[model samples]
Target: MRFTTIGAAIVDIVVARVRPVLGAKQDVDHIGLYAGGGAVNAALNMAALGGEVSIHACVGRDLEGGLIRDLLQRHHVRADIPDHTLPTGKSVVMVDESGAARAYAQRGASAWVGEQGFQGLDQADVVYVTGLSLKSQAWLEQALSSMETPTFRLVVTPGARQLSHPQALEGLWKRADLLCVNASEAARLCDESVPDADAVSVEAAESLARKLVRRPGQHVLVTLGAAGAVFFDGAQECFHAARPVTAVSTIGAGDAFASTFVHAWALGDSAQNALARATDSAAGIVQVIPANRAGLLRKL
Candidate 1:
């Protein structure tokens, strides 16, 4: 199947195991520059998994933007995104010894991507979009209003930042066939009374899923880091448990899972089977520090 990926591309600077000291320069360890962004990662994952994938990821006309283009080419994912005046988007990710990470995101060129970025996507059987790209009103509107084959699927994986834009959320999510997000993102979309306020339990996560479906029609998939994921098949829900593994880095785990799930599902896998495939793909990447397209597909 042919897949079209639309989203953000970034140069990720990851600093491992360090405490941030606001006022002084500190010793930094395990610093590496990597090509990243929700859409970029997911597109690469799909390409590696043997899907014919093409992407239109927005970036700036700077060194970092070139890096994203080279990275996608290395992974064999096609891209034709144009560069705007802003610098390429980036993230400074700081990981503590315990495998927890905090990221300072700069949505530079990423924000500049509008409806035009997705011009050729309507021809694809599966159009996968990430949380980062949905921030643009034009891009989100384009996806919602585009004319495509009846089977064309709009799979959205929105980040927590999207919650701030309620009008955008209603418009995008209401039309999206699939909604993918982490526990924290789900927590933000739900009401304060939802159980497991921390999104630590299956019941609580399903509570949030139930709410998403009341909007006539939609499917929700909530990924709970170590807890695996919860899949809402319309109103019917199921939780796929995660296997034990020492995570090297949780970054991009959700993107990996979302890509694999869409690829498998488009190929006609059952919902349960698709979730299992996604779980396995994510588990492999999380246990390794850096995952390129080849490494990720080889794991699968």
Candidate 2:
């Protein structure tokens, strides 16, 4: 599949063996810099799965931007990054001994990508919009309107930013061919019946997905890490159970699932089969550290 992704491209600085405690001096285990961001990760995953992928995002003319470009080229994914005044986006990630990570993000140049990114949207088989890119709400609305004929598939995956803006997200949700989100994101987007955002039941996920499906043919997916993922169309509901695996890190597990699901479904797999494929792909992702690395998820 030929895929075009619109979203953030960030450089992640990871420091392992750091405690969340305020002021405690401890020896660090390791430190590394890697390519990250929702769109960047998704693009890398798509390329790893043998899909022809291209990314539209902005980055500054700096060392970080050079690194991002290098990573994309190494993976055979085409990148369309315009020069910006602000430095490239970055995240300071602190990983505790237990493998849980806390990140502080600076959007920087990622917030703007200009109108050039939308020029050849109809030419690609799939155009996946990640939540971080939704920061350009006005531009996104305009782009969606211009593609009214729906010549290509549209898949949306919401992040914290998109979920915070109900009206904008609702507008995009109505037009999306496939809307994918993790269980926690689904809980936040759903009604008050879902009190806990971290732990959402399959029934609640399905209900939440059902409510979000505005059109007859739209598909909504709620992914439950480790447990499984729930798929809901206007008329059908399907759940795929996850396989057990020892996880090294789960930072980009959802991205893996979303990319794989879209890739599989777009290639004519049944919804249930696609969900199973996605589940297996996510299982592979969690087993690797620095989850955003390209080539981590191969065809299973």
Candidate 3:
């Protein structure tokens, strides 16, 4: 199946287990640069899994953009990305000893992508959109208003920041056939006070899922990290526990799950089977630091 993903294409400078003092430089156990961003990561995952994938996120005509393009080509993923005058987007990701990651980002060229970027939407069987793409009003209209209903399978994976402002993407989610989010993002979308994945009880998470289902047949999937994920479709609901693994980094785990799930489901896997596939894929990603396309391919 052909998949098109639209959102940010960023350069991630990942640092592992480094604690810094205000004015001094510190040594790190590991530091590497990789191509990243929700859309970029998801597209690469689908490509590695043998799907024909194309990405439409904006990049700049700079070293960072060149890096992103080269990585995409090496992975066999098609790049439909356009170059911008601004620098390419970037993020500095810091991973602690516990394998948790935090990021400081500059949206850069990604922030400038608008309606013109949606020109080739009809070329794919499935169109996957990340939260980063919906921030522009013109792009949002092109995606939701200008397009026909149910032209292709629409899968949405809104990040925590987008979920924080649910009102902005309300219409888009309502129109989506599949909506994917982690426990924290789900809680935020539902206006619930879920502090973390563990704190989100299955019942509470299921309740949040029900609230997120905008239509009768729409699927709302809430992933709870190692707890796995919960799926609700207004009628049926199921919880799948994650396979156990020692995590190297939790970064991009959610993106792995979303793309894997979409790939499996599009290939005719049952919802339960798709959830299992996603959980297993995410488990592998967590075991690799950076969890970008090359790392995932290496793990494979």
Q: TM-scores across all candidates? A: 0.89, 0.92, 0.93
Error of 3 at 60 (Å): 1.1
How do the residues 194-275 of candidate 1 rate in per-residue lDDT, one tens digit apiece? 3332346888788778776635567888888787888897869988888777877777777888889889988999889999
Compose the digit string of candidate 3's lDDT tens values, residues 94-168. Answer: 998788899999988887666364776777888888857445534755665766654678888876556767887
- List the candidate numbers ranked by lDDT, top first: 3, 2, 1
Worst ten in a row by lDDT for model 2: 291-300
Model 1 lDDT, residue 271, Cα: 85
Runs in model 1 with CA error above 4 Å?
19-23, 115-117, 133-135, 146-150, 193-199, 214-217, 291-300
Model 1 TM-score, 2 decimals: 0.89
Residue 174 of model 2, lDDT score: 83
Number of clashes recorded per candidate: 0, 0, 0
**TM-score of model 2 (CA atoms):** 0.92
Deviation in angstroms for 228 in model 1? 1.5
Q: Who wins the TM-score comparison?
A: 3
Q: Which is the winner by TM-score between candidate 1 and candidate 2?
A: 2
- Worst 10-residue lDDT window, candidate 1: 291-300
* Model 2 lDDT at residue 247: 72
lDDT of 2 by residue, 1-300 (tens): 799888889887777667656655766776777888888988999898889999988889898898889889999989988878899998887777666667899989988864454677777899898866554755876877876686888898877888877677888788889999877777677645444333677887788888778798999988877778899877889988889887766667888889989999888889889998888888887776665756321121
lDDT of 3 at 133: 43
